[model samples]
Target chain A: MLTTAPTAVGDDAALALWVLHELHYRGFAGVDDGLEWEPTLLQVRGLLEADLERRLRGRWTPPQGLSFVDDALEWIDGQDGVSLARHVHRDADRDQVLDLLRVRSLYHLKESDPVSWLVPRLGVPAKAALMELQFDEYGNGDPNRLHHHLFATGMAAAGLEPSYDAHVDVVPLEVLEQNNTLSLFGLHRRLRGAALGHLAAFEATSSLPSRRMAEGLKRLDLPPEIIAYYAEHVEADAVHEQLAVRTIAAALLDEEPDLEADLWFGAFTCLDLEDRFARRMLDRWGVGEVAA
Target chain B: MSEPGVAFEHPDVVLCPGGPMLLRGRHTVEDADGVPHETTRPVTAVCRCERSASFPWCDGTHKVLPPKLRPA
Candidate 1:
């Protein structure tokens, strides 16, 4: 069924594999739930996952040692390519904002659950720290304060549809593949370090763009509620970056020195995927087409 | 389309056909259908939905939904 190797994003094989992975989370409405555990499906998924992992490893090299987090943070800080946030904040029209939201909804809607799968695989300080960040993501037990809800609020405010998986058919496979990488890392217990590293990179880079996004929303005269999600990230991710780097990353390294390389790979891949996404958006925007 | 880039605001909350309550600034809820219902709450507020792992907020379920469909 895989039509091609995993050399390119949005390849049919990758998309099909991503679709198969969906059965475990929210199976398509009409699909049988029992398919979640079908042995044949598992066999196919395993092969595809292996191919995906092999390709990712070839492209990304994991960092080494407890210092890897710092290096990764520094690398992210040094990045100065096309700023998607700047465009949204300074120049984007309402439609552009809507397009950005739609693309992001592909990820922000589900937020942190994929990485949470690694919690049980972690020990002591790292587990506690990850849980702490996750607790905040979950809204600290308040059903009304969760981050995903905030994202949805922004989505609705942007006038885009906000249903879960509502846009899957339209999203480019690159976006889905970016997310699939996380699911692959999170689901495999051995890859817990990479999962944490990915979270670290994500938190490190989130704050500034979040602020830019909020500014963009405000400039468009969006209501305050819709802007709240981006604003929240401006502050929350600042704190999370530290916890992810020192607590999560450092603790993870202390526990399993061997995982340092994978941790770095996770961080590097985060940067690589985001860069690709940004390029795609900018390229489309330049061509007068909505990138999502 | 209503002229691209034209900003439009709906009522404070519009109940879509689906069950997920969409908050104007807080979160959007979806029902079995893909319709998005809009709601609004305080800044950084949460949503109230059973499927939310982060509760009142989304944890990127929309993205994860696709892969979750995969077996094992």
Candidate 2:
């Protein structure tokens, strides 16, 4: 049955859904591996996914054409709100940086694997562009330099565990949901447009925060290697931002004209969720509480 | 109960309280009854499979287990 609404954040419903989704990626240590394809679990997952999609579509208007990329780029460029990276760069302490790392690790540890699911479903230019971005994310075939590995290294430098799924329990639902959204889009072949849009939005907004994150690490007196991960994003995403928008999103529209709306919906939902996450962090930080 | 925060390279099969079988690979946790539970939850115990030093958890050692006996 389809869900009427999105699962509430941090509730058992969301966590249970997240666990079910996790089965598709990396099954938990002691859980039955066979449950990954259990019909009952898929039924529940479909409901949760539908709910999430309904909420996102309801809240965000998808753009009508390839031109939506231009509008999205403009909107992203015009956003002049308080910056999370700025806080990290200018005033964060060790604990604050660590907290940030912990929250981000929820996504970065797994890196681009979620989005990679869409690769087989995409056509030419878009697929190639995605591979271009993903190659760097995966460290261009160097196991030691993969973004996930770098993220893990950063986590380790901050005294957090580097193992995959190590911090699942501590990450806030918002963080989990952000990653879940991407996974949701990526896993569904029909949502290829949305997946690309999500990546575009992600890349568009990443550079500055990455720089700020690097600055935050430096301000906290962390080692250079710990800061390198963020610093690397500053450069990599700047390039990727262009590829994601023009090549991936635009090219996908060129191939499948009807998908423009889904693309925009994906991009906007990404931005919306990010804004919520950022605002939550800023509000917490404003009140002198740890945002993570 | 197992000590918290210890990393096991491999684990041994351990009987649960009710005689259920548990495979220890990469992460550790008690086998609840006889059913193996896969979770992202931190491993608090080791698996019992001799292949993994992590004990009470599958460190993915089962990946290379002889082609015939591999856990699907």
Candidate 3:
């Protein structure tokens, strides 16, 4: 019997969606794999996804006439929000940084896998451009250099459990929502524009903040592995940002001009979610104005 | 396998306005200091702004530069 939204609404919705999404990624060891396609479970998932999309759409107001693909970087830059990277760079203490890492492991452990789902779904030009960026993200077929593996190695070196989802229990609502948004965009072919838009925003913003993260890790004298992970992103994301905005998103726009609004919506959602996450963390830490 | 009027494609390179030069395929690039760095990825963005902390390889410093100061 399909009941009202599976009784997992409100505060638990994000986590529920995350768990259900995980079934498509890597299901739990004891859980039946078939549950992933269960019509009842999917019905619940549909309700949650619809609710999430509605709420996200409500928060977003489309920007004035402009080209999203070309202006993505500038658009992202115009949004002045709290930056967790800046806080991490100069102020966060060891325990607080550790807490941040624990929450971060929820996403960093998987890295680009969510977006990988879009490979077969994109048009040729967009597909080629995305693969160009994703090739680097996956470390150009070198498993040792694979981004997620790098994060796992760093986590292990830092004395944190490196296993996938090891820190899921400690994650905040902001973290869950942030992650669920990516999976939501990735899993649905209808939201492919949003997925790439999210990718563009993420890459465009990553490089400088990655430098800050590397410096912060250095300041704390944490394990070199962890520092190296952030250092890698400083250069990697620089290249990726270009490929994402100029090539990938641009190509996608050429193929599907109608998706421009969703592209902007996705970019806005990425920045907005990050801002909320930063505010929540700073609030928890009682930190004032982040270092300039 | 030659087509009548088609030209053979070579390795790709793209120059982003006010940004880095995107290079596809592996090659050795000498930095301003004349240090040779081997390309390690399928695609690489070489610094054009000369402001990148990791010179010869862009670390996105161009984005922070003023529009007039950005790479042409």
Candidate 4:
């Protein structure tokens, strides 16, 4: 099944890669659990990861004279990616919003699990800082407060399928690539810098946009659970961003220093992938073209 | 304040430069409206800029403000 599925390029390759990465996460039913490390499958995963990484690296140039760990929030704020949240805030109809929820459910259901891989691989201060942020992400030891579970609750309340990977088939190529990037950075010890960079970028960008999302849901009269999910992030991520950029990512940089470029690369990739996804969604919805 | 090499086990409260005050435990924060809000998480950021739409809790509006308008 791994070698034969028209896995050369585009959505086909993306889906194939996503399924391969899923082996490491929650494997599909009836699949051999040990296949997560099978040599041939590992080779295929490596080739696909290399391809994706090269493509991402080729598109990013580190921001001149800017320090990713120190200036992260401002650097990210300067980025002009198209906003799906803004569109949802003012323009999306009910059907379009529902479709977006389904697409977002791909990542929202899994939430912070990708970065959890870095826990065992980090040094003391960075590890402690990451857990400080991640503990909140995981609902501070309360399962009901867990972010992903919160998303699942909202999904079910919105009358959408709430199970993990339930919307994978409906997701566009950009969405798959976005998921794959997180997995790629998270699972590689060599890319721990990138992983935290990605985490910092993700948290820094979340707070305001989350408020927009909550407002949008309110305007649409969507389920209260769904609105609450976004509302939760508005405050949660404000705290998390400070922890991620200043405490977590900065601590890692203090120890290594050489990973700075890759850290910026990772941060840039996060913004770049989200931009691609947002543009694709907005264009599909006929919202308007996002400037390049 | 302790000497140069000092580090506390865990600083329960931190003032983030140009940002919010991070409180690491639960506390009742009374907003300008005099309504009290109890924190439910391990850490909470109390808005310092007085510009947050969320009021007592930061919604990160401080970051969007001019540097002069931001909290110290």
- List DockQ, one per candidate, in order: 0.02, 0.01, 0.49, 0.50
Docking class of 1: incorrect
lDDT of 2 at A50: 81
Model 2 agreement with the true structure over A1-292: per-residue lDDT tens digits: 5344344545566677778888988888999999999887788888788877777788885444437656666556554544667678777666766776777777888888889998888766667657767887788778877888988887787678888877778766677678778879988998988888888878777765776677778877887877988876765665566557755776677778888877777877788887677667766556343322
TM-score of each: 0.74, 0.74, 0.95, 0.94
For residue B20, model 3's alpha carbon misses the true position, in angstroms, by 1.1
The C-alpha lDDT values of all candidates are: 0.68, 0.68, 0.87, 0.88
| Candidate 1: tens digits of C-alpha lDDT, residues A116-151 | 788888866677668867887878778677888888
- Candidate 2 yields a Cα-based lDDT of 0.68
Better of 1 and 4 by TM-score: 4
Residue A84's lDDT within candidate 2 is: 68
Better of 1 and 3 by lDDT: 3
Per residue, candidate 4 scores C-alpha lDDT tens digits across A126-207 of: 8888998899999999999999999999989999999998888888999999999999999999999888888888888899
lDDT leaderboard ranking: 4, 3, 1, 2
Per-model interface RMSD values are 19.0, 21.8, 5.2, 4.7
* lDDT, residue A202, model 4: 88
Say which candidate scores most in lDDT.
4
